[model samples]
Target: MTRILPLLLLILTALAAAQTVEQEQQPIPAEPEIAEASAEEVLDIPPGDISPLAGVDLTAPGDITVMDHPDDSGDRLIVSFSPGSEAEYADLFAAYIIYRRPAGGSDEEWTNVGVMPVGEGTQFVDGYDPDFPVNIGESYEYRVSALYLDETEVMGEPVIAQEVASGQWFHQGKVRVLVACLIFLGLIFYFFSRARMGATMYLRPIAGIEAIDEAIGRATEMGKPILYVPGLSDISDVATIASLTILGRVARKVAEYQTSLIVPNRDPIVYTVAEEAVKQAYLEAGRPDSYDPNSVFFLTQSQFAFVAGVNGIMMREKPATNFYLGMFWAESLILAETGSLSGAIQIAGTDAVTQLPFFITTCDYTLIGEELYAASAYLSREPMQMGSIKGLDSCKAILMVFITAGALMSIMDLLAGTQTLSWLKNIVTTQIVD
Candidate 1:
């Protein structure tokens, strides 16, 4: 009986130890109370709204008015208010909030349109939201409220105004540009009318133009073709147009002298125009049978490739006269040098300032900047063109006189410390209207 008692006691003690181990191995229960405390600490809310500018008195802005922004689209509203008495109190108020409501709308329907910082100018331009644009030709009530740092605001008395946006056919600001354009056109027309009425206009002789006949005659006598490069640019270029004009005159002379004429072009459009121009010239010169469709041909558009092709032509054909008229760039020297090497008499004209020196160095004759623009008018000698040129010259002369007088007056004003010519200076320099 005693041995059985001892084994029973051992078995009980082992069971108790096993139970203690099991309890220690189990997960502890999560405390909901601790989680609640942590959340409260992280996101604690204030008990009530309080003003940062509490205890400070601020005066409200008065006489708030709204009007249409003059000379502008109707989307803009110009808001103005009487300067607040607390202008010196920078910290008393945070900003002025502009509020607006449609006419007859309730105070609750007023929307916060814009905000201006404290100490800002009394005027504000409210360019409304593009997505919800303000209705044009509709009345609206506006108010300005001074906002405090503590989320408190003092509203001003509201005012009602409406504006309709309309556009003018002519902008008032561009009046000066319009007047200048009209005067220039009027002068051109006046000169053209006089030219048609038998007025004789004289143009200074351009040596490059004078040598055209001699160049064509030399080509005729030498029995060699005359090469004409109308430039490397497209027909859209004014220089190219001038080149084509000169080409017409040169083609007529070529037809009259019965000399072979060759024109190599870089642009396809210019090639086409040159061909028609040459054909018309031949027809006008009573030598339509001499017009050859193959005379003007399109060369490669690549600058250097065109230069190479022209140089090859110059070498192979050894043309007696080479006319480089139009726009040229880096390849100007290449063409001029090749023509010179081929023993050809070259007459080059271009508005490209950089290429002028190259042509002048290698060619027999060269036309400078404005000379290219005047070439067509000078060559044609039509009454309208002559008269227009004369008008332009007269304008230039008047401008020169004004410039000289202004300079003299400026010097006198500086030396004498007087504003005697100040009005004249302002009249000359200032635009008619801004």
Candidate 2:
């Protein structure tokens, strides 16, 4: 019995030794190797012929073509593919994801740039990121993959392309505008050339322009100052520019008569321009010493506030003449009324149609519409300016003839039930846009 017990113990010890040897020979996995295997399990592509499970469809999109985007800054690529029988595969896709890989880049470096909904469009414009702007000479490869409802994706073949953005000298869209500008400029230059050749261009005398010299002379005779309001607008306005030009003439006249000329401006820029113009006029009139630096000064930018200040000047200074020439708005009436009440000879001109009535009512002489624009050329009477005005008048006469002909033709067609004037009317009135 004792012998049997020792045999059993020996057998147990052998079994323990065998188990220890087996454990020692089996290698323990390294942490990095385990992690690599786990990553592979997640990222590994499924078999090409794997059957789709449940709602997932394993069908991939057809091949795609890549090209540089036309009429764009070469930073974009146009990816196109045939939708390929929507009836057969439309239900299989939820969306198409566009993937891009840099030239010489690996599969791991591929980027998902855009996603388009199923049945939305077969083409995609891959605009590069502004932060990572496209390299002008760099090549790229793109792929389109179909995504299924069950989170499976089937990828199509890759397309290789490059970017090369170039600019156009003239855009097709602005051709009409360019042509119109050229014609207008041509007319101006032609008139200017004629004026330089000593051709007499007659302008109908404007009452307001004629009254300017009288107003300045009256102010000098009465021993009172002359007030000029160069509108409430800035120098950017066309009316203000015309007003400044006239101010040069008015300033020269005031200098000649040795009368005080007070020009109050609402814009700082206009104040600077008015000051320079008045100074130049004084110099040209041989009365530089008579020019006052404070004559042209900025009042206030506020509309109503500027009116009150100008009105205060009229009441206190008792200026003999007040000239309101330029662009005006609500303050036009207020200024003209204040000058009228002060017993000043008020001469106002403006392109503002709404303010014309107020000026005509409150002032002795008013230049309306085109007359305001014509005031500068008339007062200066520079040959170039005069020629331009004559050319403009000629154009106006031509336009009037066209208008009359068109109106007569339309009236005849309507009354006589004839289509004889249809072509003329269309030519005169129709507008085509592309």
Highest-scoring model, TM-score? 2
Please report the TM-score between candidate 1 and the true structure.
0.61
Tell me how many residue pairs clash in candidate 1: 1
lDDT of each: 0.83, 0.82
**lDDT digits (tens) for residues 1-434 of candidate 2:** 86899799999999999989888565867667444333223335354534334453445666677776654555777778765333365544568888888866899978888888877788987775664445555688878887755456778877776443343455555565576567667787898999998888878888888888888888989999999999999889999999999899899989988999899999999999999999999999999999999999999999999999999999999999999999999999999999999999999999999999999999999999888889889888899889878877876776677789999988898899988857767655766343
TM-score of each: 0.61, 0.62
RMSD of each: 22.9, 25.1
The Cα RMSD of model 1 versus the native structure comes to 22.9
